[model samples]
Target: MEKFELDILGCGSATPTTLHNPSSQVLNIREKLFMIDCGEGTQLQFRRNKLRFGRLNHIFISHLHGDHCFGLIGLISTLGLLGRTGALVIHTVAGLENTLRPEIDFFCKDNPFEVKVEVFNPKVSEVIYEDRSVSVKTIPLLHRIPCAGFLFQEKQKEAHLLPDMIRFYNIPVRELAKIKQGADFVTEDGKIVPHGRLTIPAGPPRSYAYCSDTAYSEKIIPVIEGVDLLYHEATFADTDKARAKETGHSTARQAAQIAKMANVKKLMLGHFSARYPDNNILLEEASEVFPNTVLANEGLREKL
Candidate 1:
């Protein structure tokens, strides 16, 4: 199986508390790192977790909220100071470029690396980034401002070769690649062997969705349906539903409702309100609706 994991750096909402930092996470797919939402103290959290700065090349910011993007400047400056020469790509709405470019130019005047900003609309669902291993799509979210979520989906894998069949047929090593690509094999005598007979079907692709700073919106269900892992904001408990709505945040129950509606494999809730003395109440509230829900916390890592 391909290696896919998520590392939580900060999970608090609005402000950083003594117990929690704000929104930041790193998604590791096949050893490549993609950072999501650089909130305050994100670099410190990265240091605490010992994440390699050089490995991270792309950052996807959901919105312009302070809690979601306050740490970006500091992180960029630190990367330059560390002598990183690789290009850094940041994907966000176009409005941020006007606000952030001046700060970057001033602080990183003599930096060695290039900062590439790729803007995407927060009102449409579209493929923002794609490579051989995975593709990332934008999920238009219902937040106070123009906000968006992200869906990281793995590409379909090649068929698994049956070693016993290969040995029995004395198949040439050079032909294996073609077979895995679904081509039929022909013997020297012109006898044909179907590719299906020599290989097992590939495992289904895995996906992860990140939704935050948005109210409960069903429009995202089709985009995130059946994802392997879902990280949704649950900033308030069910008792605070009104507050959640008024603030463009989702309650724990609301997050769970979304997860259930999407039929996701698992739900991981975060963006907790500082008012909560403990997050267990929120977890319990979400679990009542979706039994496979878990709470997001700093340093928590989930592998799929």
Candidate 2:
């Protein structure tokens, strides 16, 4: 089975610190690349991590905040310079295309790549995109602006043929396709062969959920329930609750609460405040509620 992987490009909060950059992450599922957010210096972080840029085709912007999307122009320009000729898809707010078109046009007039923008206004939660291997949906988040989280789910796979059963039943090569596709087969003599007699159920699909720059909102639980991996913002500790509320961000405890409520397999906490030079406080707080919490660091890669 193909696995889902996430690369943390930048984990710091609105401000950049010496040790961390702003919010940016990359999700690689079934060999396709999807970027969550692009903050300043994100391209630098990508290079430092030695990630291959050839497969990065789609980018999801969480909001219009600078910490979340300021690096987009630079990244697109870099992609053009790197000779990426394939069309690039950007999923963002309605006005974002107009906002970036002039700048992108000016920079890419001499380039050859195509940039396609897919707008997702925050009126509701819905499936925004679907490729052959995966589907992407939006989860409404409680941020200062009209923002949404992303859910990436791999498609269910076909059942694998049991080699022993194939040989034992003397299954014909032409019938192998039918068995793998979970279809019952009929013999040349009109004898029925059940699909269960030929194949077992395929494993559960893998999924990853991302919630960034949002305040504590339990409305997202259903959208991210039972996900294999979850990345949520933890912009402050519980002690700074007032500041967190004022900024429309969540504390480490709040992020953990969301993960626990959603029953996610693993939780990754990121978008840390610059004040906390170390992430132990956030991890410690989050792990108390959700034992599987990991502090997201710049260039950290997790294969799920």
Candidate 3:
């Protein structure tokens, strides 16, 4: 309930199409924006969505593919032009820092903020970034080149204090944190009030997984199991399964199969190929396999 939302900036594949942009998305947890895959046109889309630039301190890139990272330099330069001073941390596979550092240096020379690039191995899974609210782990994906998907798991929140119960027990304001952490309230007369009586249990933590351009691989099931929302690339329909295999992308049916096998709560199909004028064929193919499937469109927001 504290804002676990995904904003789709672009959903098209390698070929540029009038229907969709490239690959970019923003996951907002508790008002903190975490950008994933800043494809071309991502900066414009971010502004169109009215997201505050200052809140975005981290950007996670799945791979070094052009469509996935072409917008990084532009966004960094824009952040500088906006007079932002906060350090921007980019989490990606190795070689990205070396590949983009020069461009950033030449363009962002007069910028106020520092751009820090963190590298990780795409062959193995690892916890790339974490905060008090959430933890992000990489799901090693199979692609033409090295690629990794991201799995975001929310950390458990503290129990909510009951206002009426707090007032009745006369618990001091300074003791709220302790009570939320499951400490019992003690009355002045030495009577013990159980923690359950003073607070409401926090809701279950939610999770989201993103796999943009990968082949159908069951190895990711254990990592992404039972997530609230699963966004997998469905670049082609079942009829073009051969094409999908050749390009290291998954068909809609294949994506749904992964979702169903993982027992995910919902499946979002994205990274559409330009060949399909209407993506409903892909949606229908995936929905048949997983009934709770949805299409990922530009500017679309899904909460989990």
Candidate 4:
């Protein structure tokens, strides 16, 4: 495992309640900090959780909703005040820069860092972010407004070369790199050495999917199929499922069904409505449908 974990900043829905803040999470993939949403008080939670401020360079906003993005200015301002020299990039749907650019210019004009806002189309599914280790694709979600979820998939890991096997075969060091990449080693004498005999097979790559503020749509099952972890919004229980359907949100059972349908390893439900004093009922409802379900609360962290 190369340090892949998720931290929940706030899990409450639109309203800021005493029990929870709003929708916000941080994914630490190979130590590259990526903020999923910047709800109000996100920076405070980020600091409360002791995540390094300098390591956070990219923020992905699921939509333009206030709960999903209102904390952008405050976080950017705090980063500037802390003298963060790295350029901060924001990826979200179009029309967010128009709302945040002015505030950023007015509040952080003197800072050394630059805040760059990049827009993406929510209607289209595409890889919005990619690096050497991971690729994040957008999952078109059915929400009240234009919104999209994120699917984070780790790149295939390279197999480890067995020193004993290599030495026994007397394989040249020059061919070790290729062997590690799943290529067979061909000896100078024209003997075929299988890759399995030269290196240990690496485990399959891990994946995580984040789905929030959307209705229960089977359209996403293919996009998030067989993920290691799934964070889906469970804004209501079975009792308030009518409310959920009216508000473009999903019930706890609905979230669990999505996980079970997609064959995900585990399901984490978040974005709870503020009316509930605690999420015990929601958890119970979802667990009945999918036993391997967990409730997301503020400050909770889990390895993927």
Candidate 5:
């Protein structure tokens, strides 16, 4: 069976600490790497994790905050150093060109790589990017700036029949595709069969949602409903609720509440505040509200 995995690079909040870096994550789905947020030191974390920059073709920048996108310029420059000729697509909010374009041009005056940055003005939450393998959409979130979250839904794969069943039924090569597509076979003798009789149901498609540096908002529930996994920023503990609200960030309990309301299978809480000595309080508070709550640790890879 194929796998969808999330490689957590940095889980700390605005400030970088000795123990943790900033906010960067790599989603490894079906051999494709989608990067979410490229905070400072993210490239170094990528190196520590042994992830190749060539695999990162698509990038989603949640907001223009320095902690979330500061490392992007350096990463791109390194990609050029590594002789990456392939095109890189980045989906971000409008008005980023004013800040990002000049930097790219400054560093890549005569570079060979093709970098394409697409800005989406989301009026409402819906599917905005899609290919054969997966689809990505934006979710409106309440942040200090005009920021939004992202949702990634992997396309369901076709089912394959057991080898013994294929051999016993004498299924032709042409009929194999049909069976995998949930179609029953009809013999020349006019035999009738149901799709379920020949093949089992396909596994559920994997989905992930990323909410970074946003205040607790229920409006995003519809956009991330039934996601297999959710990564929500819990920049503060419940004791710092007032601070979280002032800073337009969510507490661990608030993040978990959203995860529970969205009915997500698993919840990953990260973006810890610099004041916190460790992530134990954040994890404990989130787990109180949602049992499947987990702290996003650096270099941790969770498979879905």
Candidate 6:
């Protein structure tokens, strides 16, 4: 029951409009904030949503497109201005250092915190980051540029202890940890108390996958198989398939196809084109193919 939520900051494509900003989202896992894709006006959206900036330490950028990363510098500068002292880790492609280092040096010279950029190749899928509770892996995506998606997977937890069984067996408190780790207990009378009797099965781990600015690619289905939630780009309708193909984007139908192929629990369609007055058409199209499809709107929060 720990917190696992996705907060949508911006969900529009390249052309900014009055209805939406750009691409940005915050993944809150057990109160640890991991930002994905900081597009234009991201800071304003964050403030409007009242998300705590201090809790955000790591950022994952999908690509180098302006709409995907233009707000990064501004957000970094504002964090410095707010007297943030913790280091900020940015996981992105290689060439970004050339553009961001100089800007950080000139604009944030007096800032107390440090910005650490970790580069990863977008052509191959690999584990990029890992901690005690979660592990993040890169999903190579097909885009105009070298782009990669991210998969957030939670680690398996220990088995739950059964208090009633423990009391009946008179198991000592000091032996609870061992029992949870699948160790058997021996009673004072030399009787065996199996570990299965003292603990119940652990809950299944949950996972989330984020894919944006990429064309329909089946290579990612195996990597994102059976995820709890999936966020995919739906930049056009079926009528605009030609444009979607030329721009290395996906139509609503294409996104739904990928979701169905991957067999994810729920699908979220985002990165909407500005031409559509409302996303009802896109939603309906995706829902037709994948029944659990939902539209991503700014300030929307989904819990997994």
Highest TM-score among the candidates is held by which one? 3
Q: List per-prediction Cα lDDT, in the order shown.
A: 0.93, 0.89, 0.94, 0.92, 0.88, 0.94
lDDT of 6 at 51: 90
Lowest summed lDDT over 10 consecutive residues: which window, candidate 6? 197-206
In order of appearance, the predictions have TM-scores of: 0.96, 0.94, 0.98, 0.96, 0.95, 0.95
Candidate ordering by lDDT (highest first)? 6, 3, 1, 4, 2, 5
Clash tally for model 4: 0
Count of steric clashes across candidates, in order: 0, 0, 0, 0, 0, 0
Candidate 1 worst ten-residue window by lDDT: 92-101
Q: Candidate 3, residues 1-304: lDDT per residue as tens digits?
A: 6999999999999887889999999999999999999999999999888888989999999998999999999999999999999899999988898879999888889999899999888888889999999999999999999899999999999999999999988899998999899899888899999999999999999999999789999999999999999999999999999999999999999999999999999999999999999999999999999999999999898988
lDDT score for candidate 3 against the true structure: 0.94
lDDT of 5 by residue, 1-304 (tens): 6768999999998878987788899998877889998999889999998887878899888888888899888898888888899999988888777887898999876667988999876446777688877999998888898888889999978876877777777889988888888888787788866667777777888999999878999999988998999999999998999999999999999999999999999999999888988889999999989999888889999999
Question: Once model 6 is optimally superposed onto the true structure by TM-score, how far is the C-alpha of residue 293 displaced, in angstroms?
Answer: 0.3
Location of the lowest summed lDDT over 10 successive residues in candidate 5? 120-129
Per-residue lDDT of candidate 2, residues 156-255 (tens digit): 8888877887787688998898788888878768888788888888888889999998999999998999999999999999899999999899999999
Error of 5 at 260 (Å): 1.6
RMSD of each: 1.5, 1.7, 1.0, 1.4, 1.5, 1.5
Model 1: residues >4 Å from true position, as ranges?
none
Candidate 1 colliding pairs: none
Off by over 4 Å in 3: none
Give the per-residue lDDT of model 4 (tens digit) for 118-214.
Answer: 8899887899999988999999999999999999999998898899989998998888888998899888899999999988887788899999879
Q: Where is model 3 poorest over a 10-residue stretch in terms of lDDT?
A: 117-126
